[model samples]
Target: MKNIYKGLILSLLVLGVGLAGCSNDDNNPSPDGKDYASLDDKLDYSLARNEVDFLMETYEKDADRKYHDAELPTKFTEEQNVFMQNALTINLNHSAPVVVLPMLRGIDGNGEKVYYIITEASDFKMAKKLGVNYSPKLKYARGSEGVQKATVNGDGYMVFEGSVDFSPVRRIEPGTGEFAFPPSVAQPGAVGDENYSPIVVLPSNLVLNATPVKNVTGLHDRIPEGERSLDLDEMWVTLQILDGFQGGRAYYYHLVTDAYDQVPATIELGIYAPKLGKIPQFGQSTLDEESALLGFSPVGNGIDDLQSDNRQGLSSAILSDQNGSGSLAPLDPINVFPIEPQNELEKNNNYSPLWDAHISKWTDEAIEKGYQRRITSFQDLKSLVDKGWVVSFTPDAGPVNSYVAGLNASNAIINCPVIAHPKN
Candidate 1:
């Protein structure tokens, strides 16, 4: 009887080892047959440098493609240019390139300058000509204390009645927290008045998601306009200039750091919201159909956690300590890339400013099986999902678990634009 029991135990151990080996083999292969444990391993960091050089060269060679004007140059086929123009108008109601200019709002108590980006314009003609989003819905956001009225000054800059106070130290410490619950500490950096929201009404009565960027009181001087690289600071923040080609025409985007509910992740780069439905847009179809057509899908629980009342799902950065310490320390820039579509062919020239919001949380099973670990890359997140150690879904369907929701019907979305594919 003792021998029989020992034999059964040994067989079980061998089976477990075999399964483990198969899981590792299945999850780690790159396109070139190279084994990489993390998605960052497959990324060619030099591509970003090359992209910056290309942008500089394009800027110097073609005055029409200059960065400030927000116009699509004539280099592209008329049809392609028209398509992009229509997309901006129909979807975002803006005609500008995916890249936008950030406006400095005010200085925080920390002496950091609060910045915001404009996405939509009120007048259709102005929106088309200026390449900004046009939304009648913006009128609804007006007249509220939280919703500031914006106007275009004689200098061609936007002026706002109220500004956001980004002085708060935004921090999220996971501290061995479960995925579904809130972290040990979570604080938004920026706070507006009682009714302040990122989405504001423009002088033209058109609405726009005036999402806050970062506080750049003195950080821009560290890397002059001519010299910026993918170098990480003590806070693990860096600047990444991403270039993407749509219909064979090259486009550039400036990525500084990602902001969560509030507060800029880093001080150097401009800011963009990594999650969607934080602000209201004109149509639901744009967030649904248009996003998919542009090659974006919801990541984990895609839009399921849109209800702030039920589940609070944080991105990998907000929930992990693998990167570093502090709220900004654990944040990694590489999470911006899509997990699927490792190559250009897979991407099919469908890159857009919309990013797949890969929201994630550690599973109860993961903690019990001792499988809980920091997710550092898209590949790492994908592998865990496959192993049932993590739960990932998209917002294609309605909220399944929660009764009350925050975002109006729209799923949790991410507005990040693709700069360049890692494999490209």
Candidate 2:
């Protein structure tokens, strides 16, 4: 009897040990299941806003390091950082622009959870806050079938679990005080999209300038939630890419963008919008209703409220190759369409759209300075040198003379001031 009882106890202990080992195997993850080496503790996503806060902090760090790098454009400093951080830390996502870069897996908006982090920080960490606002938020994919699991982050600091898509985020420009934008937004849409363009430029001389861009008041009295548009008189820039371009080196044209209705339209004038960065679009022109130009179309919807005061803006660039060949050619009516190769200026044919009044005034000034004869268009401005006038072309550091030249009482115009040949 004693032997039988001892044997039974031993057998039961063995069975218990086997069962515990099997359970452990099923519950524990395999080595290949995770890449925890580069992972930080999975974001402390225990609270409602915690996820957003964490992301915001992460982006703040990235942008701070990126822009403040001593060797680079060291444009934003510590003080500016504070201003940017505060401005960007927002309860209202629509009124501000935000961009997000995630290291998460299986959660992306259009593609690999990444974006071009364009921002302006005077210190409030605008870029980071923006990233948090725009990046993945755990939302349900518009249409989901049953039994579907929505996990925002397959890994740390990752995705917006519920939905694969969300609203489009606007690209932030420090100079432009604009906020939210739709994703399908056309290329030139934000940068002076003839339709939804903002007022970015103002004239150097006010006499001939157009009114700055403005918004229609009483359009429902107040702006709705999730609508991020700029307020009038705020300095902003138009972001654009021309028809032919490689990569997204977007051009930033600065403007006050408020005039039109206010301009006591004495005569139609050009508005001056300066470039804050490199203007990637090589050649430029103001299109007439009948002409086709490669650049932005002047056609837009909110002309009633937002108006660009056409005046000359200030810009400068070194013209690479200047083969002084005195030549006069007829304006190709075909240029009525956008810039095609055939319409490219012949070797010495330089032309810009300028008001007759402006040309007459400048020509008179040169004559007053004891010049032999007057030059005609902007190309003529360059030709003054060969014709015996001091046709001086100097590399400039600040604004384009167009500020003075383009300014009308209501407008300013900044056409291509630089005839730079592409640097190889």
Task: Per model, state how many residue pairs clash.
Answer: 22, 83
**Leading candidate by TM-score:** 1
Assess every candidate by TM-score. 0.42, 0.19
What ranges in model 2 sit over 4 Å off? 1-46, 56-83, 86-107, 116-154, 158-424
Best by lDDT: 1
Model 2, 321-383: lDDT tens digits are: 011110111110000111112112222211221111111122334445744221223444334
- lDDT of the structure predicted as candidate 2: 0.20
**Residue-by-residue lDDT tens digits, candidate 1, 134-238:** 332223334433344444332223344444444554455543633322345555444444333444443223344454444442232112231241121211112
